[model samples]
Target: MNAPPQEEATSAARVLVAEDDDAMRAMLVRTLRRAGYTVVEVEDGFELGDYVAMMRGHGGTLAPPDVIVSDVRMPGLNGLEALGRLRAQGVACPVLLLSAFADEETHAEALRLGARQLLDKPVDLDVLKAAVRDAVARG
Candidate 1:
């Protein structure tokens, strides 16, 4: 007998989050999911790179996330560095970079690296949702 047809995945936006803080990561995941987006949570930029590479290795069979939300500082590569690398690799997904210690230089660098927005830490969930929505619409 043939297997039953599977239902299509929801058309909700896909958002990948890279944050080292457990509590903050959880909050982001919860908020984004509650907002009806498909959220992928990672611990740091290194893991974020791994996820992106994995998707690329699938040769376009797997779709990359519509947006990436990453913290400025982490154990491994920082958000700016990761964003630069992703851009170098031709990943065109919009990025929303979050930082507790962001400065003017960092903001400039993020813009140079093609980040869609730089959000300071203790981010407001509503603002984040709006940014994500804007990123998706722009893309």
Candidate 2:
């Protein structure tokens, strides 16, 4: 069988978003989409893992996302833990972790786990966009 067409295989720089708050998730999806990225939205870290697994299960046939944006305090595995797991599994996409609680330990751990940026809650859209742009550029 022939491989899918390149245009069909890839869209604009892809971004995976895992935010537990419905409103926040919607806003992020809208903003990222408006910014010309293909956005995949999930409710929590577990769902984010599932999405990653689905992509990986296709072997290297699928194009992994350029960046991930996740909430720090979500159900199941938190953003940092999830990012660590993905890294362990050889997923190199940069992650931007968002949190309302800005604990030093969490920040340190997130950095250790390879999060590109940790933005506090009520994140400025411009800052968030800039961070995502930087992450994608880094990759």
Candidate 3:
């Protein structure tokens, strides 16, 4: 037997969304919230970095979000840069990076930095939802 959709929604997996575009961020937040994820939105890489730092509890008591969905290109730190910093600090949470114009090198770096997935822009909502679910389940 499987849990009902309503019951699953109550699982409330936390998702951090980092995107510089206001419209895209809003859309991603709406999609994740509707899918029953507790979504946190950050406008740029700096905000993402700050949130991770604040959640990086002393003695490793605090845990990061279940997954992070970030845009690869942003002012200041960028998603790859943010992911690198987080990995350096031992944040092992799954990350899904989005890009409108990523080259092969960018893809290689994302993989090297331990991102779970690299999604292209104009992301399919269904794919995004599935990726988040997979990330949470894998964790």
Which candidate gets the maximum TM-score versus the true structure?
3
lDDT of 3: 0.87
**Model 2 over residues 23-49: C-alpha lDDT tens digits?**
999999999888878998899877876
- Model 2 stretches with alpha carbons more than 4 Å out: 1-11, 57-62
- In Å, residue 21's CA in model 3 sits off its true spot by 0.4
The Cα local distance difference test for each model comes to: 0.84, 0.84, 0.87
Q: Global CA lDDT of candidate 2, please? A: 0.84
Model 2 lDDT at residue 48: 73
Q: Which of candidates 1 and 3 reaches a greater TM-score?
A: 3
Two-way TM-score contest, 1 vs 2, winner: 1
What's the true lDDT of residue 42 in model 3? Answer: 91
Each candidate structure's TM-score, on Cα atoms with residue i matched to residue i, is 0.86, 0.86, 0.88
Error of 2 at 116 (Å): 0.5
How many clashing residue pairs appear in each of the predictions shown?
A: 0, 0, 0
Residue pairs with colliding backbones in model 2 are none
Could you list the CA RMSD of all candidates, in the order they appear?
5.6, 4.8, 3.3
List runs of model 1 lying over 4 Å from the truth. 1-11, 57-62
TM-score of 2: 0.86
